[model samples]
Target: MVAGRLSRYFGRRFLGASLTVFVGVFGLVLLVDYIELMRRSAGEANASALLAAGISVTRVPQIMERIMPFAVLVGAMLCYLNLSRRLELVVARSAGMSAWQFVAPAVIAALLVGVIATAVYNPIAATLQEQSKRLEDRAFNNAAQSGLQATGTGFWVRQRSVDGQSIINAASSTDQGVRLGGVTVFMYDLAGRFVERIEAKAAVLEEGYWRLVEARRYPVDAPPEKLADHQLKTNLTLAQVRETFATPETVSFWDLPFFIEMADHAGLAAAGYRLQYQKLISRPALLAAMVLVAAAFSLRFFRFGGVQKMVLSGIVAGFLLYVLSKVTEDLSKAELMHPAAAAWLPVFIGVLTGLVPLLYLEDG
Candidate 1:
């Protein structure tokens, strides 16, 4: 009964600390993002404070998802350190409780938190992220742009049809690239000769063609003609269009499997999505490993001294883990490593890094 109570107490402390840190970080990110948005929209007449705030509120969740692991690490460390200072850990240790025994609750809690973050929080963030994009577009009048937007470099697609080939560009796109804004299409013949150019305000992918709206056709040898609507032949499908704009971060964890399968069926590379799915799968283990890391650094008896040094080491170790994850992520994105390997290598290394020290401290 006492042991169970201790476990609950430790779990509650860890969760409380983590929640406090997470909220602090969220507010900081929201404030910084709002200020940046405000600065960017300073000269725009259509931009409003409410729009910027809404965008920041929606976007901060995705950013927070990335920060969750760090919060767990810091919170766990603080929880352990505080317990050590209060002699709670000392009493627990004196009661024949092993460090692992006391730490198990926190580890379990962290794993549950990771699962919740990946399953529930991710979908909400993805939906909000999409909304944030729409609000940003509305605030900046991005749909009315005459050329490619400065951010993201927009999207480009190439199509070859029986008639000829065309290179399509858009300043902005939505609905997974099914709809495009500030569109331009350049046509060329089989012999690579310049054919014509079509500039449109918008384009939508249809059953068998691209429906361009408010378009101007400039023929190679004749005068430009304005057309209210024009249909351009194409052979691209919805899957291909989705591949062009569905970045991995913007995709929900629950939907990643379907996307991966679609990309596979379409013979398109889905490395980013594959990596993201694997990352979410490994999140629980990664967060559990972080608990071990925190325990390793913060479990020293309060009277043993060197507490500051241990705290610094913990911070440095956490930063190194973040850097390692990023390095492996880049390698995965570049296709230099398999997505599963890239997603799990850092996690494996983290577990080892934390477990080795704890094993030494506890058993040796």
Candidate 2:
């Protein structure tokens, strides 16, 4: 009965502190992002303050997800420190509860939070992130004349059919590349000889074909021909295009496996998707490790000296973990490291780093 009551009490304290920290960080991030978006959209006629705020609201979730580990670390530290300061931990210790015994509740809570964040919060954040991009694109639609110039030069796809081969380029695209603007296509013969060029105001991906709008076709041996609409043959699908255009962060954790398979079928690299999936898989363990780290730094009684140094050390440890994760992510994206290794290496290191000091402090 006593153990159960203590566990409940500790869990409540840890969760309350974590929630407070999470909300505080979320609000600050939202405010800063809103201001930045407002400033960027100042010259955009369609971008209002409300629209900017909406975009920021959508974008902040993904940002929060990225920094969640830090929040957990800080919150755990605060919780433990407060308990120690109030002599609650000292009393618990006097009652024969080990540091691990009290810290176990927080670790379990952190694990549950990580699982929920990965399985539930991630999907919602991804959907909102996609919506945020769409809103930003629409608001800035007229900011640049060249659709390509406006949207970071767009994308290119090569398709082949019985008629021969074609290279398609677009200045901008939407609906996961289903609709394209400022479109250009270069045609080649079976002999790989340049044959024709087509410029279109827009192109829509259709069943085994491209529906080009307001198109002008230039032939190598004949005069250029204009057509209001043209049907070009190709071999591509909606899934392939969508997978091509979707970023790693915009795909939900649940959808990542399907996306990775689709990319494989489309002959595209799915390293990013694989990395994301692995990261999500390791998130629970990572959060639990953060609790250990916090306990290591904050479990010292208030009467102990070097409290400030310990707090600073906890902050620095959290920052180093963040940096390490980013470095490994980049290495994974560049194909220099395996996705699983990149995703789990930091977690492994963090766990060990937290466990060493903890074992010494508790056992020695």
Best candidate, TM-score-wise?
A: 1
Model 1, span 41-92: residue lDDT tens? 9998889999899989988999998999999999999999999999999899
TM-score of 2: 0.89
Candidate 2, residues 1-364, lDDT tens digits: the string is 7667888899999999989999999999999999888888889888899888887898899999998998899999999999998999888887788878888999999999999999999999988876776677677663123222323566788889998999988876665577777788999999999999999987888998889988999999999999999999877878887787667777899999999998887678999999999999999989998998899888988897789999999899988988999999999999999999999999998888788988998998
For candidate 2, what is the lDDT? 0.86
Worst 10 residues of 2 by lDDT: 142-151
| lDDT score, candidate 2, position 107 | 92
lDDT of each: 0.87, 0.86
Question: Which residue pairs show backbone clashes in model 2?
Answer: none
Q: After superposition, which runs of candidate 1 have C-alpha atoms over 4 Å from their true positions?
A: 143-153, 160-162, 189-193, 206-214
Task: List candidate 2 segments past 4 Å from native.
Answer: 142-153, 171-174, 196-203, 211-232
In model 2, state the lDDT of residue 152: 57
In model 2, what is the error at residue 129, expressed in angstroms? 1.3
